[model samples]
Target chain A: MSKKQTKEITESTIILPEDIKKEYTILNLGPTHPATHGIFQNILKMDGEKIVEAESTVGYIHRAFEKLAERKAYYQITPYTDRLNYCSAPLNNLGWHMAVEKLIGAEIPKRVQYMRVIIMELARIIDHIICNSVIGVDTGALTGFVYMFQQREFVYDIFEEICGARLTTNIGRIGGFERDFSPKVWKKIEQFLKEFPKVLAEFESLFVRNRIFMDRTIGCGAISAEKALSYGFTGPNLRATGIDYDVRVMNPYSSYEDFDFIIPVGTQGDTYDRFMVREEEMKQSLSIIRQALDKMPEGPFHADLPEFYLPEKQDVYSKMEALIYQFKIVMGENDVPVGEIYHAIEAANGELGFYIISDGGRTPYRLHFRRPCFIYYQAYTEMIKGAMLSDAILTMSSLNVIAGELDA
Target chain B: MLISQSVQEKLINEINEHFQDALVKHEVLYDMFTITLKREAVAPLIRHLYNHEEFKFKFLTNLCGLHYPNQKNQELGLMYQLHSFENNYRIRIKTFFPINDPVIATVTDIFNAANWMERQEYDFFGIEFKGHPNLKRILNVDDMTIFPMRKEYPAEDQARKDKNDIMFGR
Candidate 1:
């Protein structure tokens, strides 16, 4: 192969007449704007109120997660998973762990699987509430935003009770949760279940049927199913296009096949449809969580594999064998099985996939994350074209563009 | 559906008839059959797959690179995962390259999704994809000095220290 140097264009002249018939304005929706949600820069070309062209630039928060995963041990990547989509950390955690577990053929207990389902559903509800509420807030609806945030605060309280951390809740370990859910935690969840529906109803009443919200979102940024699929859109964005393809239904990792729930799809595939899809999804997620809790099985919470799963803390304190196993695991002394596996889960945003390749070492040989935000960002320009500038913000917010996952 | 032995036999025969000695080896692993070919024979074989009625891999699922540090015959592996929604079947095509020089042709024209995936692979593993439209550093910054995904790249702390020292004139 030969290298060729291409010529670069420098400082092209733009001629504007004093008596211009038409005018176009460039709006820089910042790496700091409230509507951006994260560090994102969109150069919007606007003619009057309609957007002509939009260019999206990410990487303001790129931590090089793929590169980091290659150097870290398989078990050590869990915390890093929390940072991918901070809104839905458990899904990323489970995705990465399930990929590694598949590669090594680790058999987790049924109880552990149910626990994972519950936590993942909770995370999904948290993400949907925040995303939907933020969309409402961006559209100048303050009541719905406050109601949803109050509900999210309740959900975050539950997370804090389960794990020490709230936002970056690195809740689960490799094979199972860091600790079993206490009885108080179950009671708190039960209380949340009883109270959340009323708040959701309040939110829906405020924004779902409001004439102003409906007028702004009904036909704005409409995308066809064919165009969405062609652009590789997944999750709610794809579901809004009338496709009932959820990874939990299609692939069924973490024993999601055992749970029964409906995948809510949309008709018009517009901003309203996207918002409605997420709203219906929150209800479905709550139902799934309830079912998971009701059908919670009785068994070991973690896998039985001593080498992979961490031994009990009591055993680590008492038994020499357990202590040695703990040291081996913590010190990266155990050898990881060699193989490749791709595990995907229905994340709050979309299909969060972790493709792991092991070379029989403590660290992974290669790791790749199939981030849904990247594809959504790719389709952003097309989605926002010909829409009003405000509709661009509405569409982006409904899409729940997470820059951490986008620029990872 | 389980892949029938007759189908595998037919595929092998068809590949052998078309490519002659250019085909290296083909094998099935983990319920997926992979066909290995020479670098020059890739485009023709891909075209054959695309056109053949029985094997219409219309969707390019993913394209990834694998590096083997001390492998003798094949040091670097480029794997393409293709899905045929029409046939409800999938196939992986892999080609090998020497460790020192890993070059593969870009299949962006076949499927546009491969464009970003190939760029990502190139960004990390340093595998050059010839004919790629916008072959620039995607995930990393444009002026990144090292390919961070390579096994030879330094750890995070060492790399950070090196950069700091260089910037501060140590």
Candidate 2:
């Protein structure tokens, strides 16, 4: 705020109360509204139906993850990361694991890397399925949402087969996976890959060509490519604006470069394009998972580093050395390298990044989560400032602001 | 992994050519170029990088704050991650100051994305954004008196007993 900038803004964007005659009504949207999909609120000043001014309030679910990460050991922090973007919990878990591994300079085997890629892609697919189906629900198409939601259950079955949990899956360890993908898990993935596309096609046919859905989403909540970039939009939202800035493409991690897939971009960064971009990404994710599974190498599932990785249960029960190693890992006796690092992955929503500074201690000195929802949600008021109320809801759905991620 | 060595050198060269004194420190961490600067130099340097013809680092990819209590005067740091669509390169900028006088110019004037990020930094770390339009807490309660992200907050206070544990269903 310089003097010249203040003068320039006061002359252009500001309107004093005396200059306008109409009274505007303020509508509070949510700290607990169903439409928000999380616990956050917006107070919209409305002139009839058009929003005149908007004020947003977040933090209903702020658990102070960064502060908590400071005190918790690196291994203990994975469960907390699971709760950040709960829809893509495995991705968050893997992303944090990769960040810490990078700090420690721990090398993951090729098989372990491919397994990570499979799980991450599955998580991305589940994320997009929820987002796109929710867009259908927002567009008043209940059939497609119901049809596609069952597909999400299939993916969740895969998660359950891998790790015993569904939602907050503390899936993998710091170095690599806790165990190999069991035969049941492989069968579930195979079933999902075989059966999901037909359901997806049916789901898309229900919404993509429907006149009502197209009308509601095609031109609604539209943002330009430049404005989106300036507002720090990424992932499907940025791609919807025709910027092919996928983190996987830009900075490949976890052997993502080994797989070949296309990054989809949309010409118009509207609600529809956002929906379509995510749908196409889901298809690409399926393709990546196929490639990863086909090229899966044979090796030890978990990294053999006793300093960072937990030993297997059978081995720990049988061997004295494995028992001591397990005890040492569980009790946080491993040495942490003193370093500062940041790692990112193209999450279901956008670019989810973790910035960590370690001081050769069990806990990080400071940890920051670059939750994409937090950054993208900042542009909400600006994008919907002059749009209708319905468009505002559509805009939010398109942006996919998970309250968990936004408040973290 | 990182771009060519030439691109990396040219980027460093451009910054050094313009503001040698503002460049406090620089490093290549995990293949991403990281440059730290004095607190006052951040805004102008980012603005220059955004407008430079060779690298239009137009996107403010991410922004967050950090608190390092042991570092005497440099207790608080603000980090800005930038991306250039033109060149497909990324970099990080960090600036630090004392917690008692944590002040830095706002980049919200340049990128609208900085509005809530700076507010979140203020909410958690109590770092002041000097010229931000609405610099109140964005991710915490309005009347919160203490910044939670600072390292001095006691660890034992985090342990609570009333809630039901998932393991025991207490």
| DockQ winner | 2
Q: Model 2 segments beyond 4 Å from truth?
A: A1-21, B1-5, B157-170
Q: For model 1, how many clashes?
A: 0
Candidate 1 lDDT over A121-153, as tens digits, reads 888998998889988888998788887788788
lDDT against the true structure, each candidate: 0.80, 0.87
> Candidate 2 - CAPRI tier?
medium
lDDT of 2 by residue, B36-87 (tens): 9987778998999888988888988778887777789998888898888777
For candidate 2, what is the TM-score?
0.92
Error of 1 at A77 (Å): 0.7
Candidate with maximal lDDT: 2
